[model samples]
Target: MLAPVLRKIIQNKTVMIERYLPSKGNLFVQKGDILEPFQKLGDCMHSPNTVYFPKEFEPVKFLREKVYFQKGSLIGKIGAKKVTADENGYMSFDEVSGEYFYEDMPVKFTLLSGLWGEVSDVIPESSVLIKTVVAEVDLVACTPNFSFGELVVFPNPTEILEKFYLESFVKSTEGKIVYVGHYADLDTIKKARDLKISAIVAGSADPVGFSFAKSANIGLGVVSGFGKLETPDFVYKLFNSVAYRHVFFHGDLGVLRIPMSGVEEETVSSKKKKTPLKVIKKVTKGQKVQVLQKPHFGKIGTIDRVSVSSIFVRFDNELGPVEIDLPNFFIIE
Candidate 1:
């Protein structure tokens, strides 16, 4: 009998997506419109923050209720204490304290589409729904976050991410999604945040560091068990193949998304066909698995027998089958 596949999470290639703006804005794309990566979708004008000046300035000279001044123009001085308009905007005087308050003019902002897709619906001045095809990879653990950027993979998947290697990419990794290697410690996690990286993917992360990343609002993903573990070859190959492409990290859902172009037919067809459900079954002989403990850690073996919580596995290097606990082995797909 065949051993059933466990945790067979479905990774959809063509996914329906909806992106909401921070606030209501002018929507540019309508239904049936196609969108490319980073295409402008909506925009709005936002007011600059208000700046409060000290009450020392002479309020009588600027008490016109609304006085517009050029950026960097001096408003007034109070005995060698010069108060300048940091930005071009109107100012109002406080009658009680005589402090000059400056409010800058509104600034225009544009929101990008961030993915390739077909516009499915338009929520006026708020959000847009689209259908897009992508490559997906399942992760073992991740914090909640959504991010899109070019994927940059590390050269080695077994090496621990050190401060030196991360410092090398400090300048170039800003606003980009970076993939550190197999293991990441607190030092590596802190450096990534300092570099202003949009997100990071790794094989395994320290539990404490993982919590810190979540608190700091930095995106992090792990594809293997906790502690120092090498990323599975299957997952590593998938990420490496899609290098430099625009990818999305659905950290809450534990999936990585890689957008693809020029395959509309396949993408649409795949969406129409429903995926088969994964069912649990009894473990049987000849089932392949990856060992998760030392002495046999990182080794692939075949099941020789199933007895209670202990499973007997036959590794190629061992003279006889060895017994392993349930939590120490995962069936290879």
Candidate 2:
């Protein structure tokens, strides 16, 4: 029998990434220049003009529909306390809803290299292209988004620990890519969005939570298919080793990329050429595989025997040898 091959990780793969600004901005790196993860790449002034409606804001009666105010100017009162403009902005009252909103001015956004690499190309006033070697982890499913941030790996959470594990890292999670646990529920996804987490990596996710992530524009990558599943042992160990490193999550490509160190890159460059990666392979006895169905979902086992349409797998757990349909398992490469 033939089966699909799931490559959990590819080490020392060369890749190019483009770091750009939303608008035209200054470029701080040139071709062939070495870049560090914390180095500033460029900056741009852009107006997000975010609208805000303060809770309990009660506008003064007979106030103009729209008014401009300096910082600290009184807008209204919240209960017995006065509510003032937080910044120089325009406040407009919504006649239909009886609410008010403030819009602020342009702000500066600085771009960081976010990786250890060399500048391969530059797009003047816009972006810099970098060439780097990295270790890549495959994701079975992910939202359509792109994010780069410091990777934070947490221990796999038990049912009880999952509820409170994220709370412990509340202060440090903002703008970071976090590995929550083996399974993420809807509440976990909602909490991550509220905490401003850049992305979430999990072994499996609740289908509803996955849908919410897409709608909320949050990055979510799953190593295993949906529903409660354990993270593959190899993937967990790899993440633990790279914790705190700058990483890239390409949800559209279904991969998490961790840049390799300069020494590691040089070592890979000196090694003999490797053969092409195989995506399909013939099923045989003693092959490692992962079950994709219930009863043994996400479990890794060794094939004991292969038939025309089924394979008997030997798991370390007491389940002993079990026969799994060919389509219910995939070779783990």
Best by TM-score: 2
Candidate 2's residue-wise lDDT over 1-333, tens digit each? 899988777765469999998778887878999998889999998655646556587766546466777888887787899877778877887776666777665589899988888999999999999998787888999999999899999899886786577888899999899998899888999999999999999999988999999999999999977888777787898799889998999998999988887776555422222347667899999988999866888888899998889999998884668989979999876
Off by over 4 Å in 1: 1-9, 45-108, 157-162, 262-274, 279-288, 298-327
In lDDT terms, how accurate is model 2?
0.84
Q: Provide the lowest-lDDT 10-residue window in model 2.
A: 266-275
Q: Please give me the total number of clashing residue pairs in predicted model 1.
A: 0
Model 1 C-alpha lDDT per residue in residues 1-333, reported as the tens digit of each score:
334353422446469878767656798989999999789899877654787676566643747587888988888777788778778888887678666777788688677777788999999999899898765667778889998778888765334435556777778888788888777777788888999888988878889999999999999988765777666665676678767777889987888877766563354344223377545456778876777777777666789998877789998679999988877777764
Error of 1 at 21 (Å): 3.8
